[model samples]
Target: MSEHIIVRVAGVVEETAHVRTLRLEKLDGAPFTRFRSGAHIDVVGPTGVLRQYSLASSPLESSSITIAVKLEPEGRGGSAAMHEVKVGDHLKIGKPRNLLSIADDADQHLLVAGGIGVTPLLAMAYELYTWGADFELHYFTRSREEMAFAELLSERVEFRDRVHLHVGVPRDQQPEILEGIAGRLTSASHVYTCGPVGFMDQVRAVLAPTVGDDHVHIEHFEAAEIDTSGDSTFTVELDTGESYEVPADKSILAVLEENGIEVFKSCEEGVCGSCVSGLLEGTAEHRDNCLTESDRADQIALCVSRAASDRLVIELY
Candidate 1:
C-alpha cells in the first residue's frame, strides 16, 4: 500500500490550450516524496474521488513532484477538478506506482508519444538524457498549439538532436514514419509507446513485423471500449471456498465491497488496471481498456469486468 500524503499545489502552468502542469510539494515542508520514471500518483479530489496521473518530472527532483493533466470533459471529473484547484490549496494523494518502468541495459530506446500521452515519455526522456543513454523521442500532436512542454523540452541542453515532432494533419504518413523509425529492430533496442489505442495498435502492427512483441511496451490512459449488452448475473468463487452473486446491474467490485470484501482500486472507471485479479476458472467479460488480449486470458479487472460464464473462480491479491 502506498502512503497517502497531504500536498500543497505550489504552481500550475498552462502548457497548452487544454493541458496544464501541476507542481506539488509537501504541505509540511518536508521533502518526503519519492518516485521513479513512469510512476503515477493517485490524487484524492474534493469529492473524495481518487484519479491517477502520471508523474511528468524526473526522479532527480525531490523538492516537489510534477504532473501534467489535460482537461477531458467526457472524463470522470478528475482533470476538471484538478484544473479548478488553486495554487496553495492542499490535496491528498497516494504514493506513486510504476506500471511503466523503463528497462535497464538497453542499447537504445525509442519513445513514441501521441497527444497528451507524452507526459510519461517526458520523464523518461529526461532520465535517459541524464544517463547519457541513446534514445530518441517522437511526439505527435494535433498541431503546434496543442503541443505541451514544447518550449521546455526544446530548451534542454541534452535534447539538442534527440527530439522529433509531427503535426497530425497528414496522418496517412504516420505508418511510414513509424516504420522508418523502427527500421531494422536490434536485440539490444527497446520501444515504448503511450497513446490512443488506435495509435498504439498501429505502432504494434508496423513494428511487430521487425521487433519482437516483448521488445515493445505500451500504457493506456483509457481502456479500449468493450460491449456489455450480453452481461448477466453470475457467481464468483473465492479461494476460501466462498461464493458471491454479482448482478448484471452491479460490478464485481461493488458487490465485494457490499460483503466487506475489500479490494484496492483507483480510477474506478476501468482504465488504471489496478484491481486486476488472477482468473482461476471461468471466462471473463473484459470491459477494461488496458488489458491486452493475452492479459484477458489470464486475469480479470474486477472493477468493470464480470463473469462471462455462470461462475468465475478468482485469486484476490
Candidate 2:
C-alpha cells in the first residue's frame, strides 16, 4: 500500500445537484506539498474502497486541497460514500500523483472538458492564469445547473474572456462546435481534454487532424474496456534474476504479488499509473491510458500492460 495522510474535511461546497467539492486540511496541521495543476489523489472512502479524484483547487494553495466528487448512483459505491461525508470527517488520502500536466513548449494551450471532467482542467486554468500563459478553456455540459465550478470559471478575473461554457448543446450538434474549435487550432497549439470516454473519443477524432496526435493529450478517469481474448502466456524476469510465467488470465502485477514480490499499486485498471515499472528489456504492448508514447519506450504499467515479446525484463524500484 502507498503512504497516506490523514485529513479532515474543512469545508464543502455544493457545486451542483450531484457534485460536491470537499476542501481537506491535514490532521497534523502541516501544509500540503504544492501539486501539479492536473494531479489527482487516491481517496479511501468510509466504505474502505479507494477511488482517485482530481485536484480542482489551485496548485499554489497549500493550506487545503480540494476535490470535486460527482455522485454516481448506478455505479460503484465510492462516490456515494463520498457524497455522504460531511465537514470534520477524517479520511485517508494518498499523496498527489500527476499523469496530466500543462505542456511547457506549447505556444498556446486549448483545454476542453466534459461534465465532471472539468476538475483537472479547472486547476490547469488557474495555473495558466497565474503564469499569464496563453490558453483557453471550453467546458461543455448538458445544462448550466450541472456544470461544476461555474462561478469560478465565469466570475473570476483570472478566467475572464478565456473560459467558454457551452450549455445545452445537443449531442449531434457537438461535432459542429468541436469542428469550430478545431479550426482555431494553430500548428503550435496543444490540446488537452478530459471527459467521458465517448466524449473524449469524439474530441480526439475531431481535433487530432488539427493538432496532430503528438500534440493532443487526454486524461481518463477510467480505463476503456479492453478485450483480452487472444492473450498468450509470457515470461517476466525481474532484475534479481527470478523469472515468472504470466498467464493470459492473470496480470503481471497479480503474478508478482502471488509470488511474494512486493510492488506498489493502486487503481489496477491502469488509469493511475501507480504500477508503472522500468522495462529493462523486451517490447511491451502498451495498454494503459496514463502513459504517453515517449513513456512507453522504456516503461510499462505492470497492472494492465502485457509483454509483446516472449520474455520481458523489469526493474522494480
Candidate 3:
C-alpha cells in the first residue's frame, strides 16, 4: 500500500543550469517526518507519474524537506513536470525511506557524487559534518556551471574545506580521470558513490583489486543495462491456485497488475527493491542488481527477473 502526504512547494532555487532545488513543506504547516541522510521519497507528480528522489535537506531540519532535480529532457517527464511546479502548488509525496546509511565503525568516509547524483551525498555530508566525522566529498559535474549547490555548499564554513570540485572538460578524457579518482580509496575508508552505471562500474572494478567489497557501497542513478532478446513465455502459479501466463514481452509485475494484483513498485527497471517477492518454489533467472547471495528465501524482483523453470510458484501474501 502507498501512503502519501500533501506538501506545498515553499520555494524553488535554480542550483545550476540544469538542476533545481525544490523546497517542500506540509500543507498543514506542521513539521514533516524526520529522515536519514540517504533517505528518498516518492513524488506523485501532476502528470500522474510516480518518481523517486533522494532528499537533499539536512535531517536536522524539520521545517521542510528538500529535493534537487536535474532536468532530463529524455526522461519519463517527472523532472520536467517538477520543473513546471511553482511555489504554492501542492504535491503528494510518500514518507521518507532509507536504503543507505553510513557505517559507525568506519574511520573515514569517501563520498563520490557524479553529475546530478550529488543529492543524497549532499545530505550525507551535512550529517557527517554535524557529527564531526572525518570525510571528504568529491563533486563531479560536466562544468562549473553545471555543479548543483556549488555556491551554497562552497560558501558554507563547514563544507568549504571538505568539498572538492572536479569539473569536466574536453569530454573525451573521462576514463583516465575516473580511474585516478577511484584509485585513491584506502582500506580504512568506506566509499559511497552515486552516479551513472558506467561510473559506478568503473569504481567497483578499480576497488575490487585492493579494497574489500564490503567497503565499497553504491546506489544507481539509473537502471543497469541488460539484454532481453532471449526472454520467453512463462507460467506463474499463485498461492490461490490461479495461474497467469506472462508473455515474453511483458514483465511479471505487469501481468499481475493487469490481472488486478496491485504490486507496490518504484524504479520499474528493477534497480530498486520494491517488487522483490519471496519464492516458495522454482528458480528465478535473476537479472536485477538489487538482490544478493545474502537475500533470504530465494526472493526475486518481479519487474525484471523471470522464471528459470517453465513454471514458478511465488508467495506474495
lDDT of 2: 0.91
By lDDT, who's the top model here? 2
lDDT of 2 by residue, 1-317 (tens): 48998899999999999999999999877999999999999999999989899999999999999999999888679999999999999999999989889988888999999999989998999999899899999889999889888888778887768988899987678889989988788778888899998888888888888888888889999787888998999999998899999999999999999999999898899899899999999999988988888889989999999988999999986
Worst 10 residues of 1 by lDDT: 222-231
Better of 2 and 3 by lDDT: 2
Superposed model 3: Cα runs more than 4 Å off: 169-185, 238-243
RMSD of each: 2.0, 1.5, 2.6
TM-score quality measure for candidate 2: 0.95
Off by over 4 Å in 2: none
Q: Where does candidate 1 clash, by residue pair?
A: 223-289, 224-289
lDDT of 3: 0.81
Report residue 163 deviation for candidate 3 (angstroms).
Answer: 1.0
Compare candidates 1 and 3 on TM-score and give the better one. 1
Which regions of candidate 1 deviate over 4 angstroms?
1-3, 292-297
**lDDT, candidates in the order shown:** 0.83, 0.91, 0.81
Q: For each candidate, give its TM-score against the true structure.
A: 0.92, 0.95, 0.89
lDDT of 1 by residue, 136-218 (tens): 99999999999999888789775658989988646667999988887745767788888888888888888766667877778
